[model samples]
Target: MLTNACAIIATAASAQIIAGRDASADDWPGMASLQTVLGHSLFHECGATMISPEWALTAAHCVEDARIETGGRAYQYARADDGSLVRFGVLSVAIGAADLRRRGAGTVFPLSAVIVHPAYKPEKPEAGNDIALLRLESPWEGPVALVDGLTVVPREDNLDGPPLVVAGYGRTEEDGPGEEAFSQTGRQLSAPKMRLQEGYVPFVETEACRQQIDSLVARYGLSDIYTDVAISPDSQICAGAGTTDSCQGDSGGPLVYRDYADPPVQVGIVSWGLGCGRPESPGIYTRVAAYADWISGVTGLQIAAPQP
Candidate 1:
């Protein structure tokens, strides 16, 4: 979540953009922004990745109590009935190159429906089942490939985890002037555009995630803040502690691999963390490969493997 007024109230501080730089050089045709609109204005509360022509994946928390700003004021909105922070109906989306840095420029679309994983329980702190699928009113004709398919790196191959690329339009930094540098663009409706930042961080194995979390829990006396699903092998990936990590508005975006030449395949979804980029707090992302079959069921589409 964001520490700023208009920033997302996610795990709270949309976190610090830190070392992540502009992602314009990278080709992410499947990129999408889940906009939290108020009246006639809109602001991106979280990042989303289009996994299919009609589906975009993001964190359920992104839409829950999503942050918004209008008339120079910022506030949090959540309608438990619809599981969205916005009151009105119809959430808007911009797919096929929806870059915030580009001033919300991209293919605009309407959300016909939103389906959060049935198992997901937002009240639980363990961060269980944070994944959700936004059903586009229609389908996207974007250049990026849908992230659905059987192509995935097995858990056994997760040795030492692996490096991945993350992108989003969140707070630029944890604190100081840089933090508010983008606040106007990110939270204010004046410009209504924000900068998109990206970074590469290696995935931490499940065992490692548990160990580190345990140590941190006990050391910091944070047992009351964590849950069994915090870093479960079947559901999450812990990545990067201090060097670089995702935070705040970065939630619900894609954690993908860039080693392959055929664009990149998303392996994780931005979940939660203790705070921003603390030395002991690693970013938690929802493991994507673990839910391939579930995705197919939701979209009624086949999973395609990432090609080299």
Candidate 2:
């Protein structure tokens, strides 16, 4: 996600940590985090999902602030007190395993490079195609994708009522977002509550999603920013309700759904939305299934292991 109307008319960016219950740090072992570290200190940035041993998927905007390197070289994005983007030496991408809030719970990887979709338009986030791929320095010996069968729930205007799980190392409190969501401890902060959170939000119909966003657009007289905040149904999926939703840091994370006995398959990537956990406006995720062929063509790796 980009940010919101100010940045782009009626357009929403990746995410922000917001009101949502805490999920087990252990769930979704494939979950990964992109961070900037200083000495032994780590600052949480964006979330990513491991799609293969050496390849992963995330939102294009998530990597916009990052610099691409020649190799799996290290680069650091140091945040200044003024919140200005500061660079330290060559750009290095640090990847963490599961359990972000927990120290030593996840392992760090050297990111080789990141590839953003050429079709992605930052000025028009709602136009669709908000996906990206990352290549690690080496083959990852960690959790990979579940490809036993068709795990993704297709991007349809009417998915009816399907169960969905969204997990991220994003904001724990809806009101507290951005830098405030992170602790100020000089040392590593113990955020057991903020480690990794998951929410069980029902998949919403595309039309219903459009209606909610449109109502807001009409109510607030945002016709100037956007005439159709309806969001693209083929490129995005909607979820959450009332207080349950995915927030800022949740961007580029995974939206998984189980089909049967096989492990849960990722269907969506945290993309954008109006706000965190708004009653009518739910979180929107990039439909992973819709870009299967694109992902395969970009990364040259199967979305998952060959089905049995």
Candidate 3:
């Protein structure tokens, strides 16, 4: 059943990073670059977080076409109708490294399986339920390990909580000049940093978030693009400050809340937004806490309770 009440929202663009800083080598150990290999080139499509050695979490839209057949043993590949294999791209994960180009800095694992949430609607991303899990072909064998026992909790409505960090290899500019801007073909381009980029964005209270987005819709005359409820507070989290926000290429990445003296915990997954770093149009993320049980059910891993 569709758990979220609001399945339709406005301008559901994939998220990325805008005006973010470069991440250090030691930061975000669980950060995984979702890559696709075509011929001799490897392209970074989106971001993911390695939850376990063999399991990683990302957005459903990232691998929406990936299918696992009956008996859970065969992969479905595009065909030419002539019963011949159509060469395309292979999905994989590059983990343990902040910079993707550095050889030996990380290990790349081919995807064994991809499971998208049943409730997810590719056409209506703003309606919530945009999460997915990727099973690694094999367990990671690197020193950059993942921290287990990370669970999500409902964030308070107020802004008293600390800022969250969003990291990815997405474009650094949008609607502006230079390489990071969109192409004339209207495709969102990536002028990602050689290393992972990160930005600190404050949480936008649910009610305030909705109002601000509504104002944005009115100002830009986006009534045709967005519905009455642009953000579903129950299944989505809003976070952005100034020009620092998630935009294209950052989808499926983690929005981690790190408190002092405590291990960092991922609270959200980059889902959609109105525009790149627009005022009042905060980036929306899939609330991880809302689907905790679903994730556990799909991956068959017993998620630990959050510490008090």
TM-scores of the models, in the order given? 0.77, 0.78, 0.79
Model 2 accuracy (lDDT, Cα): 0.62
Q: Model 1 — which ten-residue stretch has the worst lDDT? A: 4-13
**Residue range 55-124, candidate 3, lDDT tens digits:** 8898877776666555443242444657565545677787865666653533777788998889987545
Write down the lDDT that model 1 would get.
Answer: 0.61
lDDT (Cα, tens digit) per residue for candidate 1, span 151-256? 4434355625455777776655554232222322354331112566778876776777677667765775556545454568677777776657776677777777
Instruction: Give candidate 3's TM-score.
Output: 0.79
Deviation in angstroms for 48 in model 2?
A: 0.6
lDDT of 2 by residue, 1-308 (tens): 34453543212244544554555544575677766555645665667877777787888767755665455464645447686878754322233444443334235566777777888864444556877888877777766654212234333434557667777766655545444233333445322134567777787877888888777667766677664343676667887764777766777878877544656678788877766666787777787777877877877754443435
Per-model CA lDDT versus the true structure? 0.61, 0.62, 0.67
Alpha carbon lDDT at 55, candidate 3 = 85
* Off by more than 4 A, model 3: 1-15, 68-87, 142-160, 176-191, 227-230, 306-308
* Residue 188 in model 1: lDDT: 34
TM-score of 1: 0.77
Question: Candidates ranked by lDDT, best first?
Answer: 3, 2, 1
Model 1 regions lying over 4 Å from their true place: 1-16, 64-90, 96-106, 145-156, 159-161, 176-193, 218-221, 227-229, 305-308
Per TM-score, the best of the predicted structures is: 3
Return the lDDT, model 3, position 281: 76
